[model samples]
Each structure stands twice: as C-alpha cells, then as structure tokens.
Target: DAGITQSPRHKVTETGTPVTLRCHQTENHRYMYWYRQDPGHGLRLIHYSYGVKDTDKGEVSDGYSVSRSKTEDFLLTLESATSSQTSVYFCAISRDEAYEQYFGPGTRLTVT
Candidate 1:
C-alpha cells in the first residue's frame, strides 16, 4: 500500500448526489494524484497536488475537485456524481519527479 489508504473502499450513490473520496499517505510524499479507471478508458488523471495547498487540474478534471492541506492527506470530491462517473478511483504518491508511483487500493464507486 506504500502507506496510502483510500476511504470508503466501496460506495453506492444515486445520480446527481455528491460524493467525496479521501486518500491518506504516511510517506509524506510531495506529490499526490487522483485517477479513475474504467473498462475502456484505461486510467485517467483527475487532479494532483504538488505541495500543501498547491493543487492543479489534470486531463479529466471536469466535474471533480481536489484539495490537499497536509502532506499526508488528499481529498477528491465529485460535485455531482453521475453514472458516467462510476469507476474505481485510485490515489498515488511519489517522492519526486520520477516515473514510479505507488498506488493505494482503489475506491469503487457506483452511481445508480
């Protein structure tokens, strides 16, 4: 797990509702990322934080937001969940600008 943990490993929600997923790491890594996995889309980056309160949007950031206030915690929020947004979300951490990233067990989200 590389000291990374995602909360609410399983979630069931209705369409148009809001959902939030959390990712915590004990490694105190400077870089944290959020990604979603779907059958055909592979993995798409949602958002990332480089340092405390320093966050940026990723390729697929629409409808999602992220925040990081501490070195060990990163939070991802879906303003309004949709069935199209149903996917397994992952959290990853890196110590530096390296290609290697350690991922947390995914959060499985379902929208009906």
Candidate 2:
C-alpha cells in the first residue's frame, strides 16, 4: 500500500503521441520506481528516483523518462509513444534501497 496512487488508471492513444503518467504517494519514502509489465517481459524497470530531483534510468528506459520534483510524487513520460510501448505501468515506493517495495494499482496504457 504505502498510500501509492497512479493517475489515468486506463488510457488509449495512437502511436507517435505523447503520454504522461503520474505516481503519487503519501508515505514520503525516499525511493520511488516505475515499471512496466508485458506478456513476455514480465515486469521491467523503466526508471526510478532516489530523492527529490535525483533520478536514474532503469533497464528498459529507452522509450520512457521520469522526474521527481518532490518527495511524494514521481512522473513518467513517454516522449513519443508506440504500440510496442503499451503495457501496465506500476509505481513503487520503498523506504530504502534494500527494503521491500509497495506498488500502486497500476496504469494500463494502449497505443494503436
């Protein structure tokens, strides 16, 4: 739980469009992450933020970007969405790097 929330629980857009997803938390944890789940890929990290204004790219960050301006919010944006980028995006929060993470309900995005 950790009071995590993701906006736009479901979205559908055409290819080449821009999409932005918002993740919010009331836990005030120091670490927040974004991940995408697909049929074959399972769950893959897209990006993460360690602290306010401190973020890093993850394993599958090619088409995605993330930003954290405050401790409780993390934003993920797809500069140019594609059909291949369609997936269920999850937001996670953790108190520390090695601790367990609590995930949000997830946002399903589709690109046609």
Candidate 3:
C-alpha cells in the first residue's frame, strides 16, 4: 500500500474533544485529498493540497481543516469532534488530473 495511514483505525469519543487524524502516504503524488463519507453526502471533500505548500478547502470543508507539509503527509484536524461528525475519513491521491485515484482504508470516528 503506497498510500496513507490513519492512526486509531477506530475511535470512540464524547462530544467536544479535538481529534487529529493523520494521513501518511508513501507515494509522491502531487495532489492529495481528504473526504468524509456519510449517508446522503456520499463522499464529500474536506480539504486538499495541490502541492507541498498549496492547500485549499472543498465543498464540505466546514468544521474541518487540513495540512500538507511534505509530498507524502497530509493531516486532518477536527477542532471539535461532535456526534454529527461521526463518519469515515478517507485519503486519496491523484498523480495527475487525468489519472484515477487511490484511497486509504479509512478511519472510523464515532462521537457520542
């Protein structure tokens, strides 16, 4: 697997605790993305990085944030983990705009 690794594969937390999930990639892909999978939203983007120091938010970036300091590392932080934020976080990468992506296993976060 030349992709990301999310620590704490599964987590159970109460409302209002800040949680930080990491995405470590082995591939040197330039474009990295973070997304959350939910019932109706399917997979909505949280944040993404175009290059080492260039990052941007996506459609559903609220309540979430991201950072990418190297070619193979991207981190997503939930300032305040809440019950409504319970979902699976996935990290993906695309070498080029026309290429397909590779997604990490997933991090299941449950906030009670």
Query: In TM-score terms, which candidate is top?
Result: 2
Q: lDDT of candidate 1 vs native? A: 0.94
Give lDDT tens digits, candidate 3, residues 64-87: 988888888888999998888999
Give each prediction's root-mean-square deviation over alpha carbons.
Answer: 0.9, 0.7, 1.3
**Cα lDDT computed for each candidate against the true fold:** 0.94, 0.95, 0.87
Off by over 4 Å in 3: none
Instruction: For candidate 2, write residues 32-79 as lDDT tens digits.
Output: 999999998788999999999999999999989888989999999999
List runs of model 1 lying over 4 Å from the truth: none
**TM-score of each predicted structure versus truth:** 0.96, 0.97, 0.92
Pick the winner on TM-score between candidates 1 and 3: 1
Error of 2 at 68 (Å): 0.5
How accurate locally is residue 34 in candidate 1, as Cα lDDT from 0 to 100?
98
Native-vs-model 2 lDDT?
0.95
